[model samples]
Target: MLTAERKRKLLEVLQSEGKILASELSRRFGVSEDTVRRDLRELDRAGFLQRVHGGALPRTPTSVEHKARQKESTDAKKRIGAAAAQLLRQGQLVALDAGTTPLAVLDRLAPDLSLTIVTHSLPAATVLAEHPRIEVVVIGGRLFKSARAGVGVATVDAYRLLRPDLCILGAAGLHPEAGVTTFDSEEAEVKRAMIAHAARVAVVVASEKLGTVAPHLITPAGRLTHLITDSAAADDLLAPYREMGVEVVAV
Candidate 1:
């Protein structure tokens, strides 16, 4: 078949499967593995797909800025947040990570429920200030402009001082193999520290982030006590996490 024809069919297969392996594509297209690799490279360069090890996944936006993220999935975030809030207990100390979804959790908290909250998110802390019954601890450090959160040596150091009962974590990617990942190194460090300081960790994510990946690695799915996401997430994508002992809650 012609190269153009092969590439077009490759994209159709990728769209149907969400991801494609090079060897499989080569077999299906009656081409060499080298030709399949070149096709994937070209597709990735054109911003049509994301090349991964041995495969390619559909291209997804990696916007870190708050305003850009705010435009993506508000209702899903609300459902995920409200579902996460139901896990909270009065008087338990909770640590919240910095992300639009984690901020959603703070927005859904019961007005009268009392709990001590620690966070690096400016918006989350600001909202929590109105809840007089809940003591707010803001970690001070260099601001990560993209996500509008604090992340630095100071933030990690502060986290070492207290152990939170639960941590509402965020992720740039949540893959079973790649584990939990974020886009920035410092932000990953802060999240790692939060996980270390918390007795239980709950990763709250929107449906679109499922099966996605990012640059920096946090802990694996096995370390999580709970996985909170919207109902739109595919069961096939979440199955690995459930098998790994994570309590998967789809709201």
Candidate 2:
């Protein structure tokens, strides 16, 4: 088969199975492993798929631009944000991770309650600024344009000194085994720092992220204190996370 033909078939398989293995593809295509690897590389560079160790997983919705991400699961994210917001208390410091869902949590924050929100998300910081009783602390770092968030050393260092009562994080993928993951390594570093500095960590996920695995692991699922997701998420999928002693809140 032509290289293009093989690539087309590979994409079809990836779309149908939601993942692909290099060795399996090589055998199926009657091509050398190196040739299959080259095909994977080309597809990855073209934004067709996310290449991982031994296999490739589907590129997640979070891999898209911030605006595009916001358009997906709009109502479900609002419910998740509302549910996660209930965990906030007056005078407690909170870390809001970068994502539309985390920002949604701001809409539910009580206007009369006093709180401090520290975040690397530019949009979240902007929204929090409108609340008179809320103090917003924006982390400094190089901007990750697609995520509309900051990453790199400056962002990580800021979180190092913070001891937030809770960290409401967003994930590109949330799986029973793979845990919380994101596509960017720098974003993963900042997320790890937030997880470390917070007394409790809650991951806010939309339905699309559940059961998926991204390239960069943020932290293990067992490390989380709470998992807030939309009601549309299946109980079967959440069972494994609950088994780890993490509170599962479906809104």
Candidate 3:
């Protein structure tokens, strides 16, 4: 087939599947692996896809709307959820941050695992309410409509009285240099308080968040005990956290 024809086919496949392995594409197209890589590169350059280790994923917008964002990249979130859920055990008090990723973690939680969960996330509180064994504590404060989270002086004050065994943080960005950050200042304060009050902190991020830095800084990389992301995360990208004594788990 012509090069243009093959490239077009590759784009179609990648669009439908949401991801495409280089080797598989090469085999299917009867082309060299280098050619497949080059095709992926071109597509990535055109903003059609993102090149992962051995594959390409459809280019997703970072400014995704809240409801749509919840469904996008679900497989990766599920894997991350499984890894995060494994960290929980009976009789431990946990704090779940409000975000699409943390909500995914709630879905994977074991029904029989008894724990007290303190959260300002309305969605998380609703999910935890249905779990018979888990005790849910909703932190009260002025509600943030966009994020569906409560954040204010009241929320921070309430958090001070309870110390959690673990805090599962959902971040907007994770820069090796900038540490962890979020877009909203109030949310950043809440996250920082959660980090301070929890015995351990786990930052859950998708691979795309690794190199990106956001406006509001929350905590430094050293504060986290663990960083959980998808298996697609590059080892070199996560090495800095590992070097800082933070356990990095790729789900």
Best by lDDT: 2
Measured against the true structure, the TM-scores of the candidates, in listed sequence, are: 0.88, 0.82, 0.75
In the predicted model 1, the residue pairs found to clash are none
lDDT of 2 by residue, 115-135 (tens): 888999999888887898988
Worst 10 residues of 1 by lDDT: 55-64
Model 2 per-residue lDDT at 235: 86
Candidate 1, RMSD to the unseen true structure? 2.3
Per-residue error (Å), model 1, residue 136: 0.9
Clashing pairs in 3: none
TM-score of decoy 1: 0.88
Q: Which stretches of candidate 3 lie over 4 Å from their true place?
A: 1-61
lDDT of 1: 0.86
Q: What lDDT would candidate 2 get against the real structure?
A: 0.88
Pick the winner on lDDT between candidates 2 and 3. 2
Question: In candidate 2, where is summed lDDT lowest over 10 consecutive residues?
Answer: 55-64
TM-score of 2: 0.82
lDDT of 1 by residue, 91-194 (tens): 89999998889999877778889989999999999999888689898998998888888989999889878788999999988878767888789999999999
Candidate 3, residue 160: how far the Cα is off, in Å: 2.2
